[model samples]
Target chain A: MELAKMEALIVDDHPGMRTAMRLTLSNLGVTHSQFAQSANEAIRRIKGQHYDIIVCDYNLGPEQDGQQLLELLRHNNLIDLSMIFIMVTAERAYEKVVSAAELGPDDYLIKPFTAEVFRVRLERVLQKKSAMAPLFPVLQAGDAAKASELCNVLAASHPAYMIDFLRIKAELLMGMGQAEAAQQVFEGIVSERAVPWAKLGLARTLRLQQKDVEAESILEGVISESPEYLAAFDTLASVKDKLGKAGEAQEVLSKAVAISPNTLARQRMMGDVAMRNGDITAAEAAYTTIVEKGRTSFFRDPNDYVNLSRALLECGKNEDAINRLREGRQSFSNAPEAVFAASVMESQAYSQMGKAAAAKEALGRAMALKDSVPMTDELKLDLATACYRSGDEAMGARLMDQVVRNRHEDARLLQRVRKIYTDLGRELEGEQLVQSSTQAVVNLNNQGVLLAKQGNLAGAVELLTEAAAQLPNNQQIVLNAAHAVLTLVNREGWNQDLMLKAKRYLEEVRGSNATHPKLVQLQTLFNDVQNKYGSRV
Target chain B: MSGQDEALLPAMLAASLHEVKNMLGELTLSLDALQQQCPQQAAQIEEMRFVTRQVSDRMVQVLLLYKNDAGVLRPNIEAIPPADLLEEMLMEARSLAGDRLVVSLEGEQAPPYAYFDRYLCEMALMNAIHNALRFAHSRIVIGVGRLGNALCFSVEDDGPGYVPAVLQRAIEPGGHSRDGGTGLGLYFADRVARLHCNNAGECGRVQLDNAGVLGGARFQLILP
Candidate 1:
């Protein structure tokens, strides 16, 4: 890749910037190049022929941006790996930059650059692309194995791109749950660089091996080095809570929330921790903030209001609690979860206020709708607690068993289940029930994995599918079934009976992990094979 | 081209109507390089280049006003070091003066950081300097200083004084006090000053007043 031979495309809405960039390219002896003013025009040009370079202004026209255009193009596979993309932005935004980097652009250039600065950027990108040219054709043709091998070679030869290539390679490795191999690369990178992403990768690998303590340390290292990395703080805090270091976890979350006060999940986690610590004031604040701020965000949760009402009821604010629950329902008019949770709160409020008839009405409504409950582990826990408090101890114990079974690998959730049982006056049985349910879930998951590996794919799929019904929202159970069925279908032919079972299992897995690479990849191959062949026996 | 479209364009293209008083800048730099090679013709060529750059500056000011009226103007705001910025402006004024105007950087060099889009600030300064050069009799003095709270940067000429109507227009409710609001040099200057005020941050103000060793119009920009 001689500089002069490389074809470059410059896209900008402003004629001045476009002219400036053209002059820059000409200065580097690239006399021939293409130009486009809008995203649509750029896409049209790209479709006609591949260019070695693209210099796109971050703001195209008023309608779309460079990153959005890139996403749309890559999503459709209209552009190949060898076409180097450079996004030119004024750097006015923070989120857009991160998203572009994560989605993978060749590089970025801040606006108003001099000729020298522009040349420095172009040369850097061209050098890297040329170095990785050996693998480009295979990657372009969708050969993942050749792409991986090429990436390995580039990682060894090009020390500059080693970090980036290794991280991408490790993501593919971990997707297949080759945890030991992924950890080796992650550990190698972290040993020299102390990079936040690599450290987090190592933590994720350790999490697979159930090493919470070491994973917690890696997360903490990320926090110390880069306090603004929100994901690290979140993972570290969750690991702390899961390790029963509730107070420590709360402190970590408090710092994280101070920096970025916007996620519904984090606020809900805070509320739950506050409730555990008997900090009703803090719990109300956390829940109220989430309810108020999460109105426009995708992370909005109805649990915030339900928890708030519960906290108010515990404090003897019956009127306030009643209004709180009503407000929650009014805000989320059509959500069944909100409707059900609010009804539960209304029942508790009325029962406490000595309004027996209203209490009975609310309780009956909850019971009627409980049969059609969405069956999330969270909802199950809430219902089980409600039943136990209302004196149906047997049913409550059974429901609690289900929550415990779903979260068998989660020691801290088991503790909460134990506490909930003790609160309802089944002290002796609560301990026994939590242990029994946890063991059952672990046993079933292990047995299913063993069966799948032994080529008893039919039996493994059956076993995991039945378990998914019991623990519908559990990641491990749903994924086990999806993976088992996908493996069976991918290795052997897709039997019609097995394809239906696999589709059901995959539907559950997709909801929780759309980008979990293995599941996403398997789902694609499985669906294609299922549609094309009918080799049912 | 269509008959109607052809009818719209000027038949004999002349210089832009805004003002040929500025942009001696682009010419001077180009001519200065040429003069080094041809010293025998350098003196007269240098003079022509200086005058040409001055014309270009005025042209840009008027062109900016034209575009402002057409509503096609886009301003870019970026942070610049006020001290280095002031120093550079002084150097440009000094070069244009060629011993006639003595511009000195005063007080602290611009602080390490000040926020205003660089090109916009440069245009505003260029206008005030060109305006001062035209009005100054023999010597023009451009001063950089801080007044109380904000960075009060001024361009002053040791000329007789500002024309009365122009002075009044600087303070008047609108910038359209000239014969035809089209010359718009003062108007665009005022607007650029205003546009650079707080672009998404603090509110800054641009103003014209009389306060100088030379009893002339002073252009002041206060950025928060």
Candidate 2:
């Protein structure tokens, strides 16, 4: 933790800032320092070498700001908790910039700060980092229980970081699916002081426990008190969405976007919620911003273009949708999924424009490419829509049934399915299909759970594993299989084949949604079993 | 200007000021390097750095005032150790004062952690420290203490006390002394202080007194 021993990277577009930062770092005895003129160069340097610290300017020549860079680093797992990252901003309204980020830097320094101030902030962060060093290994190993235990010890020893330790403990509990315990910790913090973060944490915990009413009230209070807190807005929108108020969620997201408009995830969420609310104009605007701003950034996704096209088609701008799909097809020329999505959307646009021949041609192209790439539920829904529009009811029904079977628990997708069916005047048939598919999955899951309860772990594992194989994208069934496998291993002896099966099941769920609540618990259980049996698998 | 252009005027000005402030920050570091390389002219370099910091601080004040006008200047209050804040101000003051003045902490120990905005309070206290460094005959004392239910940070200097006119203006609402400088620092300090309020709805304020612990001027920023 010595300043002289720390290797640092300074990221700034201005040569003057680089020179100034270098001089300042040297003044603080930080001799081993590197400089990068932009975020891309900084990322490149970070990939090549390890740096103990990174001091990056908030404005990095318009390509990517420091916050976006931090997000990229975090999302890609390029940076870990061991290193320190500090953001430097000249704007006094820096809260907007920092709060908009999903993963903020370790600390931020306001611009025009002297070397003395910089040293103080750096030293403070270093102290906190060292205090947290003991828990990192366990945390990285996915041992949430052990990490929570260490948090208590660290809070006692490092009283200055007690709240920080408690916050981590709360998040760990949430990750382990112990919503009640997380709620207690958050409540303890909020009772002493209604800190905005603590309130937000409590609201999230409440939502996890299905207490949406309480969560909604707390989030409303948080947003009113701290209007610039963008995270609160996001959480509030989610809670509202869970309460079936997509229109209200869109309004809340609009306010947050007005305050700070550059967050890609927020923009995407805006596009989604607006689309759900049938505000096609707002959806088009949000998707347009995403497609424009994300063109050259890591946040760019081919789905953004598809989404934009969908909005345009909804707005009766078929030619514009077709033009956008053509451009998107070229931009993502080598990605099969992108090509497939563009083709499907193109067919939809053509069908909407009353060009049956063109639509039929596009549909043929899409069907040929469909099997070449994995289909997301959204893309499958689009293909189904295209099929129905092109007078292929049987093909559309088959696709819809597959989607419903795989994502039976997804209310939003189910709603979209219903809309598609209603638009085609097949509401009764669609309802029956949805009910039968959902009931089938529910019966299978229930039977497995029942077998496990009857002390027939082998029977439970066999049933759930087969169900999971049949519906690979079904997170609930996959998680149940993994849980049964781990529970059997824990109760009986560890079986190598069963352990690998459990690992694969967990990995499948993680590949689709890493932050799934059941994932961390199952992963921790798997790790514990592995450690106990002393097996590499 | 068009209506749209007029609406963007504050943001444009704020951006320009931020750019200027960054340049001033660079100039300050250059002065620090120059002082190190040419120790004989360290005092002169330090003085130039002092002026550069003053401009930078003024830019921040203007930007903050604009935010206040736009009703967005909310303080991000946090629990910060009082000693750390005082120590930071002491270091900056000593660097600016160099060998000309004795800048020191007033108390043996700092108070417990207090809830306030560290950056805003630092800006206010540093402005007072800079004022003290300008007029102090020999020394400046920075300290933190409790005032009733509020936390108080004071900058006391062994300099000529504030003039009666300035002291009177300090007590007046929206008052600025037209004595020597633009009085923006005091106005900004007052605005920053008022932005901090406790759950009990008690707002913070600035108090100026001629009777100082250093037998001169004493400026106190009291926050609830």
Candidate 3:
């Protein structure tokens, strides 16, 4: 709680900043501070030690900026709530600063600041962290209900921390799947003051309640008033996509990318949306930026290159497409999925160029590599298309069947399968295959749910878990399996092996759709039961 | 110039300014360490620190001017408590003045909150406080209060008030003092004040007047 007792890390590529910060900390009687000259070094230092405070410059030379580094830490669950993160940036870099707001740093200090100002800002951050000290330990220990209660009491009594406590309370409720309670808190905060973040939170709560039209309008107002709010753009685009307005989502993502092109996630989103909407030029441009800008960071996904090549091939740039696929394979040589996708793309490009021998060779390599990597619905779709185009209709149909059996409820994928069959002039056969596969999976899911509803928790869990293992790519089935496990544990008491199985399914679902409502529900239920009954393992 | 080249010009200027500021900061730190070792030369060291701060402040003003000229200067507004704002300025003054002058904040009747760009407002206020500390006979006071609907924060000194010509030039746009003062600080403070606008279409403004609570020169920034 005291400045002298705190351990601090200063991250800046500039020696002057490092020296200046050391001097300032020395003035405050702090002696155990460390300095890092780059983001990579900062990450290494942080991983090896615990720092109470981090003073990071916004720009850290040519690699990942402070925001991207923070994103990586948060995505990997590396940062705990107790540590204070202060982003130091220069004046006139308002766009980046605004964008960083969503990353949830403790505070930001504009550059060209004096030691006195630094002390003030640091003290403020410390005071706020002290106020939040009691809640984080409870929440991190997986006690959401107790944490929510503590926040309610704190917000009711502490006027200074009322706003902050309310904001935390809302987020906790949202994480606990109590959307109505979170919506109430967000609405109260918005009515008291027209803060853009509070309004955006309210929109998210509305979305969770399936009031998407109202959420869209609220997001529109927030975005129009605060054009620099990148998170609002992302949420609005999702709302548009859910409403079946793919064009609007693409436009929203376009605006966000224009404002802050350095963010790789937004570029990927723009590329995906463009490809889905059949805008080959836009898809190619977005993926091009993603591959080029993400090359230096851990965010570089081989899929961006593969997708770009596909867009190019569609646009009739066969030579450029082939080059892209080759470069992609070189960039992500260790990732089997990336290599497989690249090989598939290569076959597609070669076949489009009328090089049948080359296409056949590429297809052979892809089929050999496919068994070594975990199969996802998206990858299977790509491989199936490539197989069909290479004159292997039987193998293509088998792969399509695998995709359908894995996700019978995915109407969009079913449509794609229909189009593929129509292209092969076997529409009737394709329809029969789709109907039978979807019916079989649907019957298994219904029976499991029925077993759970009839109080046969063990039977339901066994059936669904086995089914999910058979059809690993089925998100709905995995989610249901987790739910069944959670209910069984809640009623029948703790079982360590079953708990691990549930956690695995929840994690798998999160990997594919992190924001899915069903995944959130299952996650909350699983954590609640585990926290209530201590883990035996 | 093409659009890309034009944009690069400002970026290069900002980067160069940043490098120079860092060097100045390092020099200030070394001087501070030097003063601790050689207490007899503390006055001389303080004078050097003052000069360094002046240079840094001028560079900041030039960068701000360029940003405004390029139409890229937009305030990031935040709500700051009055006490915290005043305390922050006093800290900077203490670092600059050392033991040569006293600096304090007076906000007994000020409002609880003020909405403005904290970074810009602090720079403007620090410049005024630094100027006052130099001219003050022995003490400077930063006064915070409400003037009608606008919030006013002023820096006042106990030394002789600003002369008639200096006071006249201070308020006028593009006017410099005849006594070798560039008056960039005053111009910058004025511009920062005018950049803040309230929902009622009221823009912030600056006032320079003699005979304050300290019976000396006063620089006040009033924001709506």
Please compute the TM-score of chain B alone for each predicted structure, in the order given.
0.69, 0.92, 0.89
Tens digits of per-residue lDDT for model 3 on A26-67? 798777799998877888888889888888888898767787
Clashes of each: 19, 0, 0
Q: Would candidate 1 be rated incorrect, acceptable, medium or high by CAPRI criteria? A: incorrect
In model 3, what is the error at residue A187, expressed in angstroms? 3.2
lDDT of each: 0.67, 0.85, 0.81
Where in model 2 is the C-alpha error above 4 Å?
Answer: A1-7, A23-35, A44-49, A99-103, A113-117, A353-361, A388-394, A449-455, A479-537, B1-45, B106-112, B145-150, B159-170, B173-184, B208-215
Candidate 1 has an lDDT of 0.67
Candidates 1 onward: DockQ, in order: 0.02, 0.32, 0.18
TM-score of chain A of each: 0.63, 0.89, 0.89
Candidate whose TM-score is highest: 2
Tens digits of lDDT, candidate 2, B39-146: 998767777877887888888888887887788777776666677778778887887887889988864444446677888898899889888987799999999888
Candidate 1 lDDT, tens digit per residue, A128-191? 6776788777655644544666779887787546665777677656644456677998898766
The candidate, 2 or 3, that scores higher on DockQ is 2
Please name the candidate that would achieve the greatest DockQ relative to the true structure: 2
